[model samples]
Target: MSATAQALRLWRRAEEDDAWRLLRADNAPFAVAVLAEHLGGDDRRVDADELAEAIDADLDEMRSYGHDLPLNARGYLTAWRTAGLIARRASEGARGETYELTVDALAALRFLDERESPRHAATASRLASLSMQLTQLAIDTDPQAARRLERLRSERDRINAQIASIERGDADDALTGPRALERLRELLSQASEVPDDFSRVRAVFEELSSTLRAKILESDATQRAVLDDVFRGVDLIGDSDAGRSFSAFSSLVLDPALGSAFEEDIRQVLERDFARELTVTQRRRLRGFLDELKIRTAEVHDVITVFARGLRRYVQSQDYQRDRVLRTKLLSAMATAHAAAQTTKPYTPVGIDLELTSVASSSVGALRLHDPSEYDAAADITTHETAAVDWEMLRAFARETEIDFSELTANVNDVLTASELPSVGDILDAHPATQGVASVVGLLSLASEYGTRGDEVEQLTWITPDGIPSSALVSTHRFTERIP
Candidate 1:
């Protein structure tokens, strides 16, 4: 079938499908309301039992409204799945199955629940969007250099006019409160729609995969030819309209600087006076919508990765060889059957049953125990008694070696008060080393704390407690005298 015809058929199916019809049913509003209340938040999927309980609770309140509600939540979900309003898939591990709204279904529900903006329409935002779309379309579709040049010239003229207006003090043309609110609403709406688009793109990719698999299994072509066709089909999918849009969306979402800028802009908007008009829920929704888009983008990428891996495995496995063998066996059997039919009075079809068994059994092996005595060993050891400490000798050693930091600090401070900017040498000259190198280190520490002068280096010579001379290079410092 032609691409146009296929698209038309799909559109017609969407319009006339039982799922679409279900949306028009009286109970649909209630069903959609329940879904929106229970599943419309951050959750992409809900457990069947949890969804049932939620539905039952909603039905309890809804019963007072004299409306009949479907208590069988699972049945309702199955119906919706059959209609393409939602999808049911086996949950991971042992969590049974889960149901999530399909792209079309979500769009439908969002449209139904959409309300008119309380703020005035933003002409600037609308015009800007239209202008951007037109410019992009022109650039993409028109390859003529003359047309491109003309577009550039026109854009320049528009920019010049805006600049002139600004210079003329026509700042009144700036966005007003209502218009800003409208623009904010527009941005929120666009962001909210991104997740649905990702869901649609994922669906398209999955459909493409299914088509490729079917072709591989049914085609009479050689394995190489089939593999080539599969690759070409995959490329075609990646270049499709949905694929291109999703790729662009992913790039935008993943760009750190752009994401940060967008978040900052949203924060700025939220702090505006007009933002007070928005309810807390609305504010949170606007703020969180971008994060949700990022999550959806990640999910789409994950799906693509999984699909690529599965496709790679399918190609590498070379199942076509087994398929050929099976075909040959079937042909041989048919020929044998024909020969037997010619000789026998009557021929009857016989069934064969094959029993398959695992190569390994599920029995556990015996555990081995180690003897403690084999690992345990005792070795001869020498022991020393605790030595008695000489308290007087330790006191003498500490008194001879101990450097007083407080006395060093007082001496350094005295030198700084006497000199406008003192070097390490000057501090040493003012106070001769009593503790030797240790006192020099204390002076350097004090100079560092006082702040260094402009690239001035100083050499300091000090004697150790044992009378050995040591020299060190230190940055000269300018110290301001502390006020009383």
Candidate 2:
């Protein structure tokens, strides 16, 4: 057990000890009457004699029992003729001065005296109090540290409240029943009979049984609002479409990526009620979404690299200003061609269009180094211009920047060469929804091609609702596209 746990156990053992029971003769020297008399009080010089007479024998006996010199009783008396139990200060004033318990000692004894509950509770209460005091002390010593401690204390209180609620079964508490609950045991036995999906079933059942484990922690509104502002700067996503979007604001958190954090947060909430009322299809769907998420992560990473390169190009060059008109003309023409091409029914290409559309280049124009006149110094401008550099010079610069030529530039040639990337069809084939189909090129492009090639685009490309016939869209009233 932890030190806190051990101390709690000892405190509880002591709380269960009642003063009346301790005073019983059968309790002997360890009895309350003997222990009580050892407490002394500041009763002045006259009452000192009486207090001394009453406690002297008990003190001597306790000292004989190996409690030795300057025990609490001796110290109390030396300090004040009176040192006694704070609770009995009234009618037993004289007796009180004769022998009384210290606050900590009283707390220990009270913990031992409990018959109503575990003594650990009293210990916990006292420990919490002491801990708060120590916390306050540290906060006083460091002003900046004080602010963080306040946040922690608020978090601690929230957690404590949640724990209390669970213990009381007030909110969404699920764990219930006696040790070795018979119902749970029987259910497990039945679940084991079907061996194929044991792990999944057991996990669901555990989530169902133990979902009350969220620690019931909560922060205050003021702190909550402050945190709201801080995290607002973070695009924390929950169950909405943003959560599913790879581009969600939360995905950009530097400290800890919020996409993973969101998945984990929602998983905790759902895990609590996993098997409670969940359908088999729902379970499968959840698992599928998680699997899809993992696969999509790699796709997102690749897309990030492509975009990063685009950004660097934009930042380094005069892109839009130089290429805007040409790009617009090309994009418009391409869109028209694509729109018509998508409808090309009988001519639908079944291959992996492993090509990034000529769209980006259409906007930028061709890349080439040329001089119409052979005598022109186009190649030697580097020697005359202020801001001048070329590709070969760049390669040399890279070699110079690298600390170790042998290690850093060892495979630079291979890295510089571009490799063919995996195709779109390959990616879609890996997904569960479309995995059964070995060929996806036709499935995805069929509608678009039909639209372009067929005489009636609307009739060819529009989707009728599930279970409804295409005949439903025959009416002129409900179509997005009306062109024949």
Summarize candidate 1's per-residue lDDT along 345-434 as a digit string, tens digits. Answer: 553545666578845555555445678998665876668888998999996575454445667778767876777766668777888877
Q: TM-score for each prediction? A: 0.57, 0.20
Candidate 1: 10-residue stretch with minimal lDDT:
228-237
What value does the lDDT take at residue 243 in candidate 1?
A: 65
lDDT of candidate model 2 versus the reference: 0.39
Residue lDDT tens for model 2, 254-337: 225655675685465446533445455544444344344444344334434443344333322324334545666888988888
User: Model 1, 428: alpha-carbon shift in Å?
Assistant: 88
Clashes of each: 0, 42
